[model samples]
Target: MSGEMTQGCPPTPEARAAQRARTLARPGLEAVRVKGRLRANKWLLLRRITQLGILALFLAGPWFGWWIVKGNLSSSLTLGVLPLTDPYLLAQSLAAGHVPYKDALLGGAIVLAFYLLFGGRLFCAWVCPVNLVTDAAAWLRRRLGIKGGKTPSAWTRYWLLGFTLVASAATGSIAWEWVNPVSMLHRGLIFGFGLAWGIVLAVFLYDLLFASRGWCGHVCPVGAFYGLLGKTALIRVTADQRRACDDCMDCFAVCPEPQVIRPALKAVGQAHPLILDKDCTSCGRCIDVCGKDVFRLTTRFDRSES
Candidate 1:
């Protein structure tokens, strides 16, 4: 959401402590009872606000004739003044041998700097429309206790990222955008994506049937590019109370990238308390679900150990 990931009414210290005594199969269910609904879903609701608010801004032009923001997520001009462009899209243009104009480069730079300061996959967790679809599938999978299909390589996204760039160079086009689920979802909402909706559905099914978070985590080149950009992110989720963790693993159940949790949550050696993995989405669901108040959203510079 806002990188702060801190808002809404929080529960009392006693209510928070109530969570340590219970671990539910449904993530956050215990928190819902102990911390109240709003506290349990604080970050998630904030992310929905951001995601839906961005969509509303984009749709305002077409539906209401009010041009708050022109263009979609790939490129946009806000209030006829500030230009915000997707840097990954800019990279594809470069690979396609297109000489981007000065304004375009400026737009990309503005966005690049913003994401660099925060975590890059903030786009994935907070804004991208397809994320809603994928998240639904993941929720359904977990609810159904569906397990074991195909475990896609976590490295698959990196390879896909390279292929997209090389394909753009070879084809002289932004190759990946041709089938990008995000673009398709945006177009589908405005007008009609037609058969393109199938690709989006395919992504959902893959996550539901094949694996949890199969597409965004393992296959999407866009996520891979942003994950790489996130390596130097200043905003981080830290395990400030790792010592209080009861090994309930609720954080893992809720996290999109659970692999990023251990280093911070179990910092035994030289590991810092910060969740430093580039793949950490900074989605704040970990913060939302941790009953012990183990995880926190803060600057990467904080060296406080749990």
Candidate 2:
């Protein structure tokens, strides 16, 4: 104890300064490493949760085949059929040949009504069966060594939407709903007694094995509709950085939608750090992925960032 106390009793000025610097630097480096590890774990957990949820829903929804979950001839007859099974109805209504306001309009109105109430979040984050199926496919794709991919070009959805409307107009029956895997699977089971389910499941398995949600972000008409409506929604999640960013670009790399990340990057280090746009699904993944705690989803809207 006497020898140790003597050694620690005093230090040269240079040694003390060196020791101080080491102490400060160690904490900073450790903090960075800890933050990075935590961020990685957070995203990994989020992806796992989303994938499991999707798998559960896909396995359960059709297995139960509840009337509310399963659309049938009634959906075709009363809800306005489209070409897949009720195409004649979708066509008649869209073409102005029949009053969609009276029949098919009910579904569309119900959708629009929900959007107005909840800010159009349902189709993307909740309601769409195709989205659920595609999420599962994406999870499988990741399991098969596909690490990450972006939604195709922004205009992809717009073109698809236009094409769907035009095709529906031309055929005098909407066809988008027919090619829809969700609707197709439903009809396949009801009409072909699960043959449709088998074929659809095969396609889904293929998508999972190869591509990542190839059908949802780029091809789904309903997603396009929700996207358009979501543009106007009042609630938005965004990134915020009160301090100077390190410019590590970790947030951008982890972002699911790169286009929106670009703009967010431009705003960083400036007055506004979080300028979110239409591409944001508000999934909050970015928030979880930011190691420096730069991203946050807050209701306090700042116009400068917007």
Candidate 3:
């Protein structure tokens, strides 16, 4: 008190006003209200439809006795003609020294081709049933003001991916499916919701309270495998209209993988605005949140900035 100023009892009027402004900046859906909610949420709505529709296809076969698709997410035969298999699962089987049937090999090849062209993590955003639970948790986390508790390194999933293969080799069987939430949820939906509810609820709670994006973003080996497949994907999200960005930060808040946005959106001297990161899930949340329409889905070859 003799030579220095004492701390104030409370923040000044100007500081309070600045704090208020910062709080208000978290507009959530209001960030896109000016663009019309329907237009802004178009991608989100489409994604929901795709996710539910795929689930319906599988459920229809078992529940309604309609065999449109005759298998779980791991492997399936559509209309008894088209076979689809999870390439990741096939890799595990091979690691376990199990040679898959010819149909399974062909199915994996077909799936590998599709993901190679359209982006692999598209499965996470558009098809996986567990995504519904995680998205709901994320939504509730934001509304409840629950900041993430702890975030693990994103590379943890890659290590887990390797562990899955090594575990398969060591056990001489596909081991991850024993605890994979996606497989459990799918089986629960088809069979009965016994232990599946516990798995799904655990994931929901994990993302809601434990970490911001703990599962798909940090732990899921399946997602890690698919992300590697998408390293050279043809389809990508591009910040085509990045010049129109007004620094709103809404996209960053909504993106599951925010790190992928920077290089494309703020490439000071770079001519292109393509989000080329393999980790991007192509979830379209960025497109849904940006009021300026700064982002869009396009092929990697089309790099002209808007």
Candidate 4:
């Protein structure tokens, strides 16, 4: 009687799995299709806008003279786009016997503006060529399932900061322009070929194939500088505390700047809602990926308050 009863019941596990599969398959497919379409549209728009901007730059490049130009703008008197040009300007300033800091350009208004609006990430997103190259490298790494470890502790960026200041002092602010990857790439594109050209082309290609923007977290001196200044910025990436945050570090995993994210996650508490690390670039990547809606770019300085 028992054997017969078991046979009549059959396999409940198999039956239950079949039902579950049917329930999940359609919803999953629909979600994929919707996501695909949105991504396609966004890509199309970005392509068109970038093409127009590049055309404008190409036309403007010759007029401005990428090497250097004699202008009357005082601080930016020598208008050019090449990395070495800044060095030249610094040399010129020294030759003319001008002291540093006594006449430092206070034109960091744009940088400050972005900090006020979105934290220290304005320069990361808008300027900095190294950021661009690293972003591309990250994209390539991701598409290929490439995982990179954190930078060596010995290679801390504060050394680079000191170097820039010393160089700028010696060369008349040319140090900032010299190491700038933006100026480096622009100069290479305009006047270099062979090895130099190959380097730039490879960076661009890698970005096309990978996560593209992940490299910024690993390197980028200018980004580091802004990040330090960013602590006092009006806008910042922070997490909300009202939600149940079981050690589920989803926010940290998705963050491009994990150095900043990890500390913030560990320090989050009932009283403090946001992660306010000096290393935070305020990229907002964390906010986009948090499932619990416990993350946001907020205006408050208190990182504990979300």
Candidate 5:
């Protein structure tokens, strides 16, 4: 008896009832009804607007003859003046033995500086077009409760990031761009939907059936690169009012990177309230779903619990 493992007790009836109550109500269902749909979905709606708006600027040139923006997501000159280059893409080019012109470097710096200030995966939540597809897949996954997917290591993305650079150097080409879903998604819409559609669909299904947030959180090298870039970002989601948490777990359900929340929300010292984890998307769904208003967007310098 001393050497053998003992059986564990089942959950108490009260605990079971609580679980039932939490499960019966969808995450943020109360917030949706009580806060009104618009207010409840404010951050999400804003994200959709920003994501679509950026895509619209890119699409305008081809679809509407506007030419307001030139080139694709990899590199672009907005209004023939503002150069926005994806620094990660530039890294791949350099690995492939290509030195871009000064504008490209400058554009990369501009983006790098922005994410350094505002957090990196904000790009994932607020601007990337494939995010729309992934978000839709995540929403459907939650609604359907289709669980039991593969749990890949989140570190996989970092490894993939390293692999990409090495692969580019070895092959003398930007290897990841050959299958980069973000670039494919952007170009597909601009040109035609053929292979891009498949890439997007594969990503959608990968997240839905294989893992929850399997790609962006655990597999995408771009996210891994941006995460490293914004590790010390000034902007962050802070659990300032965590004492008000009633164990609703809505924030956990909705967060893209749920792993980042627990320490900030439940840490012994309330002074450590900022979600400083680089994987955090700064998506604001935690703020939106928490009826207690426990989370908010604030700078890392802000230690004020108020």
Candidate 6:
């Protein structure tokens, strides 16, 4: 007791100022200046436009009766001609002992073919409305000087994906839909906002206050399913210009799946500079944030470092 300090003292002014300075050193600031603000944020702007445009297509039918698309993201018919369905939902229906209609089978096949050709996580980056919510939370957390809280195991989502399928089989129902925030949000938008707002808000707070990239990165089973599908995707982000990199780490900071970048960007002796990780969302944030333009979206077949 005698060795311990008698009273807790507040941090000195200099210490407080130093903390502020450290927080102000946000990533991509240098890149913004060097690359020009608009050029630096090019991919981010495209992603926002894509997300909002998809939302508009869905909303126009329900809100204005334009009827461009006739359902939510889980299942939809465009112009009463093009049918699209979530393959994961189709799988759940099968596990629940239900034979989907021929149209549903065709829709699922169409979606599967698209993802197999491109990248499955493209859904997460380009279409999922929930991505906007999670991204806002991540931005706020960075601004507020938030540090580590709870880091869940990356494998948790795969386990949850397995559990959802098993539960569907055992209960004869699509068990995950009851708690799926994506469906809830879409339904709320078309009908009326209710519990969907609460669910979305909870996800935002969870990421901002408790964990970094928690929901999308660690807990979403939907993302896990798509990740598995993307294992052999033809399109990918390559670090072919990695030799020009100045080790900014800005790409790592902005990347939702930062672990995927290291092998490609830092592979000194490796033959390829392609990011082959299935978890890589192909979001193009690295391309936007890198001053040296180290990353680019290209075919997986391109292996040349040039």
Instruction: State every prediction's TM-score relative to the real structure.
Output: 0.90, 0.59, 0.91, 0.57, 0.92, 0.91
Cα lDDT tens digits, model 1, 64-183, are 999999988889899999998889889999999999988789999999998888889888999888888988998888778787898789999999889999999999999999999888
Q: lDDT at 230 for candidate 4?
A: 66
**Under the 3 Å rule for N, CA and C atoms, how many clashes does model 6 have?**
0
| Residue 231 of model 1, lDDT score | 89
| lDDT (0 to 1) per candidate | 0.84, 0.50, 0.86, 0.46, 0.84, 0.86
Which parts of model 6 have CA positions greater than 4 angstroms off?
A: 1-25, 268-270
Arranged by TM-score with the best first, the candidates are 5, 6, 3, 1, 2, 4
In model 4, state the lDDT of residue 84.
15
Candidate 6, residues 130-149: lDDT per residue as tens digits?
A: 99999888888888878889
In candidate 6, which residue pairs clash? none
Residue 19 error, candidate 3, Å: 8.7
Clash count list over all predictions: 0, 7, 0, 18, 1, 0
lDDT of 5: 0.84
Residue by residue across 1-306, what tens digits does model 3's lDDT show?
001112444555666555344433343445456678787788889999999898999999889999899999999999899999999999999999999999999999999999998999999999999999998888778768787398899989999999999999999999898899999999999998999999999999999999997898999999999999998898899998998865556787678887888999999556589999998999998888777778989999999986
Better of 2 and 5 by lDDT: 5
Task: Write the residue-wise lDDT of candidate 2 on 139-200 in tens digits.
Answer: 45644455445445657767877777777778766557656565665455445535556656
Return the lDDT, model 3, position 138: 81
The CA-based lDDT of model 3 is what?
0.86
Q: Give the Å error, residue 49, model 5.
A: 0.3
How would you encode candidate 5's per-residue C-alpha lDDT over 119-233 as one tens digit per residue? 8888888888888887778888877877878968988998999999999999999989999999999999899888888899999999888899888888989988988877889
The CA lDDT at 145 in model 6 is 74
Give candidate 4 regions above 4 Å deviation.
1-106, 109-118, 148-150, 170-173, 186-215, 241-250, 268-271, 301-306
lDDT of 2 at 162: 76
Q: lDDT tens digits, residues 1-306, model 4? A: 011124336536555455334322221222224345443234224433553344335435455655243221113322443111122233434544565342232323333454545656544544344444564455455445544443434245556655666666666545655445555565554455345556556545544443334235534555566666567667665665535433334344435566666544556333465666656655554454343445666765664543
